[model samples]
Target: MRAMVIEENGGPEVLRPSEVPDPVPGPGEVVVDVTARGVNFIDIYQRSGLYEVPLPFVPGMEAAGVVTAVGEGVEDLSAGQRVGWAMAPGAYAERAAVKASLVVPVPDGVSDEQAAALLLQGMTAHSLTHSVHPVSEGETVLVHAAAGGTGLLLTQLAKARGARVIGTVSTEAKERIAREAGADEVVRYTETPVAEAVRELTGGEGVAAVYDGVGRDTFDAGLASLRPRGVLVLFGQSSGPVAPVDPQRLNAAGSVYLTRPSLAHFVADRQELLGRAGDLFSLLAQGRLDVRIGGRYPLADAGRAHTDLASRRTSGKLLLV
Candidate 1:
């Protein structure tokens, strides 16, 4: 199998396209003939040495494909079944072996490519909206990087829940994309103070919650944009990791709540994993959710994908197929 192997964690160019042994299923695992793989920020983190991984590893976390073989003790799924998985390492290959507990059935109406693009980002958005704070009707939310993969999905999900959305983007092109995703307003954060704009939009009252993935760059603004007791869900550190600060800062910032949530913790149980995927696929099948997949690279072009994502030049979901 041709896989994208990182000889060492450094630059995107460190990724090499090389022939590797095909994966074999172990007990309670399944080998997937990967059709598509989702490129995420965590892949960039791993490639850049921000997230530690053993040397010479394949770099991908989500993929959708056909089951080529199922290991012992796996009875519910069979060979040739359509499926997708998140949290599966080594997905930047033609094939990967993932635990059966991590694989989820692809709904009849969803395609392999779409499922691959949506799994990690979609579930992350679901956890942020439905699990982290569970946005309710008639509330408001501020979504940073609102044109990115999780941003678009989170915008739609927030709108679907009857919440008015304020989206921040760095470019004008993303303004249209965010608006299409049902954001009530879009701010070009590069040109204006987004926290002030959100306050202005809400008549001097901040939103119920702020979903911030851009950490250091947006942390100060996120705190100011929240109302008293508003929740700030810091899920990623795209700009940079936030520096440690006193917990009293939360109290100083209108008694706001700050949380750094991770998808792994939210879906630790198999039931939670399946439930989140099922809800995402159901929404996709019903045409209620629109997943915008912007880039697709072959497994060999993993370096270019990393470059684009790390440079913030890609939007929606970037896929390696």
Candidate 2:
């Protein structure tokens, strides 16, 4: 099988395309013939050595495909079934051996590309809005990078929950994308201070919550954009990791709550994994949720995909197909 192997961790160039052994199913695992793979910031973190992983590993964490083989003890899923998985490594390859429990059925209404695009970021958005802070009707929330994959999903989900969404972006194109995703207000952070704009949009009340995936650069802004006792969900560090803070800062920031969440913890249980993916697929099938595929690259162009995502010039999801 062909895979992008990270022999050493440093930059996008570190992802080298090479012929690797095809994956075979082990007990409780299934080998998938990957049709599409999602490129994400976590892959960049791994590639850049910000997040440690075993050397010479494949870089992707999510993919959608057809099941080529089923391992022992996997009764519910069979060969030829359509499936997708997130938080599972080795998806940058043509085939991946994923745990059967971690894989979710890809509904007939969704395409392999959409499944791959939405699984990781979609579920992350779901967990952030549904579990982390639980946006309520009439509550206003702030979403950083609102035109990005997870940010767009977060904006739509928050709006569906009846919350007024204030989104932060860097350009006019992104602001338009955020507004199309149902953001009530869009802030061009490059033009104005995000917190100040957020406060002004909410009439100085701030917001009920802030969903921040861009870390370090947007962390303080997120803290400042929250209302008293509001929560700040710091889920990713796309700009860079945040510096350690004194507990007093949280208190000074209107007693704001801060949480760093990962998709792994939210879908640790098989049932929870199925539930989140099912909800996303249902919404997609009903045409209520839109997943924008910003760029598509051949499997060997994984390095280019990483470069595009890190540059922040692309909006929505980037996929390897």
Best by TM-score: 2
- Model 1: lDDT to the true structure: 0.92
- Candidate with top lDDT is 2
Instruction: List the candidate 1 regions with Cα displacement exceeding 4 Å.
Output: none
lDDT of 2 by residue, 1-321 (tens): 889999998978888889988888999999999999999999999888889999978889999999999999999899999999999999999899999999999989999999999999999999999999998999999999999999999999999999999999999999999999999999999999999988888899999998989999999999988889999899999999899989898999899898999889999998999999999999999999999999999999999999999999899999999
lDDT (10s digit) by residue, model 1, range 1-321: 888888887888888888988888999999999999999889999888899999879989999999999999998789989999998798888989999999999979999999999999899999999999899999889999999999999999999999999999999899899999998899999899998998899999899999999899999999999988999999999999999979999999889899999999989998999999999999999999999998988777888888888787678999987
TM-score of 1: 0.98
Per-model CA lDDT versus the true structure: 0.92, 0.93
Candidate 2 at residue 169, lDDT? Answer: 93
- Model 2 stretches astray by more than 4 angstroms: none
As for candidate 1, its clashing pairs are none
Worst 10 residues of 2 by lDDT: 8-17
Query: What residue pairs are clashing in model 2?
Result: none
Q: Mark the 10 consecutive residues where model 1 has the least summed lDDT.
A: 306-315
